[model samples]
Target chain A: MSSLPDRRLLESWQDPKAAPYVRIERLTKKFGDVYAVDDVSLNIFQGEFFSLLGSSGCGKSTLLRLLAGLEYPTSGRIHIDGVDVTDVPPYSRPVNMMFQSYALFPHMTVEQNIDFGLRQDRLPRRERAERIGEMLDLLKITPLRKRRPDQLSGGQRQRVALARSLAKHPKLLLLDEPLGALDKRLRENTQFELVNLQERLGTTFVTVTHDQEEAMTMSSRIAIMEAGQIMQIDTPTAIYEFPNCRFVAEFIGSVNLFEGKIVERQGDQVLIEAQFGGLMRMRSFQPHAIGTPVMVAIRPEKMRLCETPGGDGVNRLQGIVEDIAYLGDVSIYRIRTGSGLLAEMTLTNIQPRTEQALTWEQEAVIEWSPTSGVVLTE
Target chain B: MKRRSWPLLSILVFGYAFLYVPILLLILYSFNESRLVTVWSGFSLKWYGELLHNRQLLDAAWLSVRIAALNASVAVVLGTLAANALVRHGRFRGRTGLELLLTAPLVMPDVIIGLSLLLLFVTLQQTVGWPDGRGFSTITIAHITFSLAYVAVVVRSRLARMDVSLEEAAMDLGARPLTVYLRITLPLIAPALLSGWLLAFTLSLDDLVIASFVSGPGATTLPMVIYSSVRMGVSPQINALATLVVALVAVAVVIAGLSMRRR
Candidate 1:
């Protein structure tokens, strides 16, 4: 408490441009004997849309709570700008948390609920009215001002909640699965709306979600957490393309993994005799010995299927067609190799059902270029 | 096995008839012209006119109403506080025992509560010389002793049914605890608080045994006057008074029901 500089508090105190809008350093939280967040550190530049993506019970929400000052760290410090505010209470901190349940005041009208925080700060009557009006307009919930939370639809309540949280315009905005309560279609649309709003306000937004696609679509950078630790932190493309472990690769997207050993290395590309697929290769940044074991992660769409099948450059494997799935706009084929291993090949519809489709038990070939397969060393 | 419910309905109807027919009969007899009780000579308003002229009975009714109103106000305030303390505040030592003790008035016989309160007041007066005498104040104390139990039960149920997150959400949004309770919690539970108060008021109004025990010479209440009239033998005026009392209760029930329904 004495030496820690709280970044949010400091941002509220200083000019917003001078500091990263949110900073969390070595923040750890414990629930009973289980460490919920173990020494997590991150910095979000002002106006950046950051996301904490993880599986359930991965402590993503806990980390978000620490950032919002809803919960305190067991051991480290939080700084909003450059000042230490590790011990600052949530109300006094310059951050607002939108709860997953929306946590709207049920007895109040939409206008009164949005005005709750400003009224608590003893804002002048006229100024509070203007701010509330601006927020309702910004979220486009002006017509719902007189309705209670239960009367409005889920999307409407969600907008009212967003308006309420943005009423104060704190330097950092923490969203705890903001789109989770909406229906699927509404959630997708609200995600874009949320991104646009954050862009317009230029406020640092920290979102916590278990839905990987939501995180990927909205986040500038994602910190993938698992079991109280942040496994990797990178841009969405980097995380998807260059996962450090099988967990990150599998968690972020559907990837076909084949166990293999590095038989030869040519700079960044490694050639391997995969036990399951019989000769696979990948380009990996992590150095490996000539005989070291690794995992090859290939996305479904990346694997190419050929009827004639005479290719040898990077990751070419021979398999028989075990099954075909005709999904809309695309067809996925399960290719069974000589080793009886299944590799998935997803074909986007370039033609009708004839050219790109395969029958069960038909002999086929599944392959991809070297850059498509990613090596997961850990 | 599917059993017909008409038998159970028949029993309930018989039970209600057993309980209410005599009261209805008294209400009808209040309009009789005969001075003799139990004989319906003709429909008239003579006894009602006589009841209005009975100054002692009127004074006693006023005294009873005053006592019940005062006792109900005190009970509701004290009960609301106790209910909140019991439910919201965390556990402490003797909590289970305290809860049991709080329910003693509700389960204990009215005679016992009346006797114990009278004894406690007399002892306190003798020891501290503060009360000096027991009359209206004593009866009010007795009414509150029993009514507080009802108030606590009602308010505790309301608090239990309440969504506690409303308060926590208020605090998170920057309202202080006192402000949260005032602006959110009190309004949400107001319906319960009102019903609790009205129940306590009615209980105080209807009490006979406890009030009889606690009353001194000047504190004779309406029920005591009515009982004395009944003991003296049924009279036309007493039936008329009973009808008036039944009307008052009916009105109170209607108002209380309307209040609850509005909520």
Candidate 2:
């Protein structure tokens, strides 16, 4: 599959002159005294595929429902294509949603299911038939046209749902955990297909998913949500490389955080006295004064294990390998440092079969580059 | 395993026989050549022919069919509305009270239901000068009142089991609420409605107590005529009528089961 063009090259959210296609301002929804979505403001550009990423009950799905007009906001305004649709009913809104259940009409055949939206719009009969034909071909389900939803497999049902939602050609498409029901392999394949489809159609797509890998792979940008609020929003790589706070860093991927206080500051490097990992020095662009408590967050793959001591132990430590997890393409090692902190490291197993490797309980030196980790304040 | 299954099989056979033997005997004796019910000299269709010639029983049977059909239709419409309100309306005012009132007749004693309905019709006639005198309309109304409970209970369970997202998906696809109900919700719950209607029809057709209490002199239903005839003596004509009723119910049940499978 060809790689998708990076829509984030024009970071329009940062540019004041660029107009957003869909804008939500101060969106909040409450269910009896508890807020499901709280004061979320976001701008999605045309043809951009954005994902709201969070665990269950974190308000990601609720936000998507608000965009689809499935759920009314308690206090907010939503504008699609410059028209306010906050109070518009779902049937009147120019947006379609692919439900998590797929929600294919069990009584209708695949073709009939895809044609339902077009029929609801009162399109002419010929045009409705043509659109349904196109959708059948696009989703590669022409052979299953005569079969009801119950006859199709999970992945086929999902494609049919996608085809139905897209057949209407709405200004925006909302997906609620679109691939949540598929097996791992099908989910991985469908993710790229969804991105490609969005690119071809040029419709602004907003998807809600708890799978961080899916969001990182398909979304032009992702919003990390926590407790009914957005914690961070950025391109996937940016979010992974430079999470603004502890929650964003931990939520996106696995990380080893060393809680410490800054003891000394040099030109661009700082010396930190970590409570568990001992004294360490690292370079960061983030500016923090001396004696400020902070977290040094480093991804598992960023750390390198060595058989020998390296250069006076700056950004390095001697630790015993406590455990080893041998995944097919890579091996993850958990190391217990002399200071009693366990640091996890992932390494690609590229060596030949004849080569020996470090086993559990062996002492080794683990080191990372000075610029490899980020400084988190919260 | 043999020891365990043997007793279980015996219980199953005994249960079925206990339930079906009387109906089987009635059907068999309906064709008995002898006048004595216990003596089956030979099979004959004389009683069925006699039943065809009795104008009173035929008229009563025809009236029962009409009332049951009308009652089933009215009960289905009203019961579907009640079921939707109970299942879809989230925590509305008096929801629990309305639910209790709708389902109470399902478990309420038939004698109490009949007497209460009789009183209600009498009061309505005296106060509003309506329902001039109990006849076809009163019998149909009474049947609908009790049948509504059974239909509503069946439809409510069905509506509850349906995924709410299906309707929401239709709405998101630009179907208005009414259109969604027609295109998605109705089709999904049709089987339940069919079974509910069939149940209501059978119940109304077989009812004697409620019909007896609410019915006036001119509207004698099939069950009332058959009961009065049997109170005098067990006639072969009554056995023939009972056999026909059983056959009709079996056909209706088979149709219902087949339609459920199609879904």
DockQ for each of the predicted structures, in order? Answer: 0.42, 0.87
lDDT per residue for candidate 1 within B179-198, as digits (tens), equals 98999888877877788878
Question: How close is candidate 2 at the interface, in terms of C-alpha RMSD after superposing the true interface residues?
Answer: 0.7
Highest lDDT model number: 2
lDDT of 1 by residue, A1-378 (tens): 133223364433144556565667888899889999998887777777889999899999989877766678999988887777789876677888787888787778999999999999999999999999999899988889999998999899889888988898887888989899999999999888888888778888999999999999998788999998999888788889878789998898778888888899888888888877467767777778889888888889998875455656347777788888898798888888887788888988888887655678887777787888688777
Query: Model 2, stretches more than 4 Å misplaced?
Result: A1-11, A306-312, A353-357, B1-4
Calculate each model's fnat, 2 decimals: 0.42, 0.91
CAPRI quality level assigned to candidate 1 from its DockQ score = acceptable
TM-score quality measure for candidate 2: 0.96
For residues B1-89, could you state the per-residue lDDT of candidate 2 as single tens digits? 44568888999999999999999999999999888888889999999999999999999999999999999999999999999999998
Residue B173's lDDT in candidate 1? 72
